[model samples]
Target chain A: MASVLPRTVQGPPVPLRWPPEDNRIPREIFTDPDLFRWEMDAVFTGPVWVLVGHEAEIPQPGDYKTLSVGAVPVIVVRGADGQVRVLVNACAHRGARVVEGPRGNVLKGGFRCIYHMWTYAPDGSLLGVSLPDDFPVEFRKEDYGLPRARVALYKGLIFASFHEQTPPLEEYLAELTQGMDRVLGDGRLRYLGSIKVIFRTNWKLYVENIYDGYHVTALHTGFQVVRLRSHGGQRLVPNYERNGHLWGQSRSTRREELQPVLRDMSLFDVRTKPTTDHNMMVVFPSGVVTDYFDTIQLRYVLPLAVDQTLIEFTFFARADDPEDVVRHRVRQGPAVLGPAGAITLEDAAALERVQQSSVARGDNVILKGTPKRFPPYRHVDEAPIRHFYQAYRRLIGVPVEEGTP
Target chain B: MNNADDLSVREQAARELLARYVRVVDDPDRVEEWPDLFADQAEYRVVTRENLEAGLPISVVCDDTKDRIMDRVTVIREFWGAGGRLEDRHYNQVRPRHVVGPVWTEPQEDGTVRVVANFVVWGTPTTDPAPRLLALGEYRDVVEFTARGPRFRSKWVVLDTPVLQDVFVYPL
Candidate 1:
């Protein structure tokens, strides 16, 4: 909550190229408190859609979970009408956070603000304010109902938009779902479990890292184990791209991606047949969805500060999967992607190292091995990074010259 | 030894083994000795209390066998070998009580004793001001009664705090 700043306090004009070229990002943007403020204004609050929670998480009616989009608290609840509602968690009366902790089922009288006892229904309707007879004449109870953001649900995943005018979630993700990356398989996703960790790095760095195909074979330690057993001829290509959404495809079962302890041959055999492939998707701003091997993980990134990022990783098992498959997901999900994932741990260390060095005056280069305007799907191309930077530049408040991206 | 004395000896041995377990885990220089502390088929995990209560199948460190534990040690040696995560030391001091309801040892005919103890481990990272609480939880340990000494058949680390900072490269 401390990360969100007032809109009035302005900072110096950013001293750099308006639209950075050659896949270069000004290092100041990584460390500048002012740019972070503008990011809150333009990127987060301006037409950006945030993925709040999946319906499976708040299954029962009256169940609610607390989340935030750039420090603005939000409550994702299931109403008695059986529709999931996304409401601002701040109390309308005194601005106190109405929901406590991460999640819970609503008690009697809906949710009561502990600070002033103002109550609200599950549908975000105002129930009552404390000592209503003593209120001023102009104050109407109906006028202060819990303010809600525009909400949309696609395949059980809930998305909320804070902007006054943003496209629907489906329209926003139009091009990508047609090809390359598509998951949430047949709309029967089982809610497995969750874990969160704070990285000592900028939030953008982690978001870009998600669609990264270049670094997988090099950085993640577990990949080496799988590669050793996998058929050595596998290749990765930019499988799909559109509207700030990008994904890569490669064989999910190259050598049998085996965990030494829990042997699930299916994970290794997923892509061996022509039927399946691994997919990584990044919905602009900071919603990452991945489906590879035996697990489906949703990466929710929260920008806490210029130098700190909070990442919540939630894994899901297929609803139709047997107990063995679910157990396999529990064992193997973290092995590849969570806080304790083999490659994820290394990524955290490398990101923090960059955070320490990023404060200096410099250009963070992304044009490592690509010459194409949109880059390619090769293991070392900067295409995904370039794709993200374009969306970021267009959304940010600064003016850009003609033909920037 | 008689019944009372035999029980005392077993408890004393269990206590010493538990201390040695912590000492081995805390020493970064002696990482090779970690896998030896457990039996080959040992079950090890570092899980959140909430996940445990909700029956959620997720963990910070979930290894069903000692081979996976050894793999972690191998990663520290090769993957994060030179300069991986922040340099740190662990201070694990087990607070044990004499005969208690939840902690009574059950000796098995298969040469194993099930012992449960409580522990609080502190971490002193190079960047932190002082030692801070890393994890505080109960250890549901299965100690084998071998002639060579007590070794863990399984050790479940159920942490009360779910949220953790950065990476959990090292074991809890």
Candidate 2:
């Protein structure tokens, strides 16, 4: 018999009280500041792919959007050559931030650092610096260009990684691509807009909440009031033992069958897709892609601190959509999915309460559909959350027991 | 009454309508009174300054018609379990308070008056100790002197900051 090789990760010992049963997660991890900082290094900057933006967001050359990758602020800009580059927002000269607003086109003048007027091209190559003649003997503009992350595109979705050893985008996504394709269609999407909100909870709670299907009908009373239930579907964890990405697929009740709760029932209508089947997927660490009803949304989870997370809900429409269809999407997208949406504020309420009580010190147990400790759970199961933590444990240097998977 | 006094009276009514709006939304018990402040065919939308300036059509809340405006109350009171239903109490009970200042009323070429004011809202959760700043924005409102009273023709809440600190249960 051949022996399995043991993987090792290095970090400071977390104040975690993990139990023998893999389902019980200690509350300390949510509140520990040291662990949060360590995660920025071990999990984010470690070998992992983080979704930054979609190609439709910056379709034109010199168009750019700014966001943070883990703790590092980055600019996701489309170069004049039609390639997307995730450059660090800081200037090479004194490290002053280059980009100011949320998004804009730099085609006119490129990114200029206001501190000393050091400027760079759309592709992040240093174009000029003020008073460079009085510099050192080895002064080279090529060497002083803003640092950037390795970028990969799966369809139109853009993913960025700081680590050199991160796997290829296809291998990283695994079987989740099928679900993404089902939602993305031909990948020709039009960017409508985005609503950025701060959730008063850890980033893990926000991501895990998406994996937890058990709370849907319970916490969100709107779902219950509409009498909408999943017809038939299952929860899938691709590469469960390794990455533990969640693909929650389900076919929902038709709009005609739903109860008339709202005066405008258009919020529940699904006109774009052929069937009522929808996907809510978490791409490993912190990328949420879902096509709930006719609304297509992508959530970027940015951890601001141990207790706070910034979630930008970016909505989209198919490039070939008609005017009425676009209007329906605009009216329905934020009404149901955005921060203050009818069904969405309940999550913020629930998650904030959870973060409040995490200081009480105990294990938050997972009971719903944890009979055998693996994937292939029901559509209304919370068991896939365990796999999420398992991948998290591997990255954070916590050892899994022998034959755990 | 003199022409100057009549003009001042009309402005007072417009300002009073604005005052009544802040009073209704700030009280948790008076959420039902919110939609009534609008005209029969009014539009209400809450959009971030970034998206608004960029000409993005998406909004955090887009109640463009009277039916949708009335439905916002239904969503808060009945759907969200905020109507004192203990069995299905999912949403947190927060006391909303709004601060309005530097009001401006511009009479358009037509009879409608445009009211602009800088406002900030604070939410104090029933369970938590600290009060959270929900949103700070400028309200670009159009007030029509209807037969009933000065009702809002349209109210656009333009947020000063793009990042909302937390989800707001009531209208801002």
Candidate 3:
């Protein structure tokens, strides 16, 4: 339970109590600078795992990619010792980012800070200081190693946590990783590519949209028209399993109609069914792995500000996938996954409007088989949203009251 | 034994044909000409320079088949127009997707012409008075002489920038 903070005697900005009992979220959560800082401290940089990249992305020893966990810049690198490490990108001396661009290979002497020529090993150990001989007598070289977060991996997707008390990735994911297993069957994911874009909305808003199953048909009507008309709905099932994890299994029927010259032959694994197997799994905080109609991918999100979020729709082709099949999968992934993706394109418009309109006084109600009333959920049910809000409330240190936003 | 007049006539004809094609592709009012610009089995892909250089398969806009290109038109008219977010662009309500200037054309050998053009697709939201550049990319094209005169054998829109402001509801 979240400990209640003092009310009415506030000098600082926290959550408000106006209408206090409704699931109608206060607009401040999406726009306030104070709330963003608090969430960075209490939720993102706190006891939570941030999904960054995959082991294959940095297959070489010196290969590295820069990413962000919350607002903290991170460098996911494979060290010379064959270990994947997540080092803070800030230079130990001047706080300048170590890894400059998105990613590159620095095999020889770790990362070198262009600002002051402070070099660090691939494993984040301090290596050289150009003006080292003139520092304080008590300045020890060993104490200046790059700060690192705890790195972990499930299958091939890499994740890291800032806090030491954060539970292991297995425990943090709970039984949710079981669903992830199906998506990453055998875990031999070949890096296809990624389309990176920033959403002009809060990162939390984008994460919540992942679990908002209700918006599938209404918001993305064109896609729904295609899917429902093409594939006879094989019953959309939502897995609101505990721990803020969500899994959805829905089969598409339009396989034969839209079959290209090279179709998806379930090149992934024997466990993956062709048209009948469609699943989307969202890990807590901001990682989404979706296996839609034989095209598998992950959506990694990073928060930049209260009203901005950077996201990457990284599509993959299995290592053993046939050449033509890989081409087909590539065509399929971006068609419906990223900024220029299928239904996602329309979704961006609606989501931006939601953020833009959150400045006014309003309370949005969640009902109609929402999480508060599950057990008899339908394809059109909003139950997953309730599950998200419950998890969000707990994570954001907001008191959990039934039927409250 | 090469005649300057013959070469001048050929170059003028090629440039004129390319100029006509650019007008049809660039004008929002003449977007209906998109279908006629492609051959029966043509490929038009709007991709990033990075993907193109790497020989990657994915694209921002991939319309390999003639049907997919037609689907883009039908989908835009039927789906995007019916009453969704695109309607919210109050600044220029007629059609938000259009190409800008700098349509450069170069004549190539064997009845082919290489073409290049830069464009910015804007999404003028009703909330803001100014129109936002949704995507800025150059059209890398290879036009050839087909049965139906000059047509787009393939057009690859190589977007210089990585970010596309919001949605790509229309042609790049």
Best by lDDT: 2
Q: For candidate 3, write residues B1-172 as lDDT tens digits.
A: 3655544554555556656665665455565677777767667777766666655566777777776676666456444443445454322142464555576666676666677777777665557656777777787777777777767777777877655455666566
Tell me chain A's TM-score in each of the predictions: 0.88, 0.96, 0.87
**Worst-scoring 10-residue span by lDDT in model 3 chain B:** B86-95
**Which pairs of residues collide in candidate 1?**
A214-A379, A229-A255, A230-A254, A230-A255, A231-A255, A238-A377
Specify the CAPRI tier of model 2.
medium
| Candidate order by decreasing DockQ | 2, 1, 3
lDDT of 3 by residue, A291-400 (tens): 87666888888888888887887878787888877877776677656676545766666677778888874765666564454433454555566666666666666646
Given candidate 2, what's the lDDT at residue B54? 95
Which tens-of-lDDT digit does each residue in A1-405 have in candidate 2? Answer: 111112244675565567888889989989999899888777887778999999999999999999998888999999998989999899988989999999999999999999999999988889999888879989989888888788999879999888777889989889999999999988989999999999989999999999898998888778778888999999999888788999999999999999887888899899998999989999989999999999999999999999999999999999999999999999999999999887888888889879989999899988899985787889899989999999998888785787875
Tens digits of per-residue lDDT, candidate 1, A20-108, equal: 46477777778888788678767776676787767878888888888787667788899887888888888888898888878888845
Candidate 1 is scored at a TM of: 0.86
Chain B vs. true chain B: TM-score for each candidate?
Answer: 0.77, 0.92, 0.73
Give the Å error, residue B26, model 3.
5.6
Taking chain A of model 3 alone, its TM-score versus the true chain A equals 0.87
Which runs of model 2 end up more than 4 angstroms from their true locations? A1-9, A13-16, B1-7, B82-92
Give the fraction of true interface contacts kept by model 1: 0.48
Candidate 1 per-residue lDDT over residues B1-172, each given as its tens digit: 6876766677767767777777776766666888788876777888888778878788877778776777767655544443233232111111221111235566655657677777666655554455545566778788876656778888888777666654654565
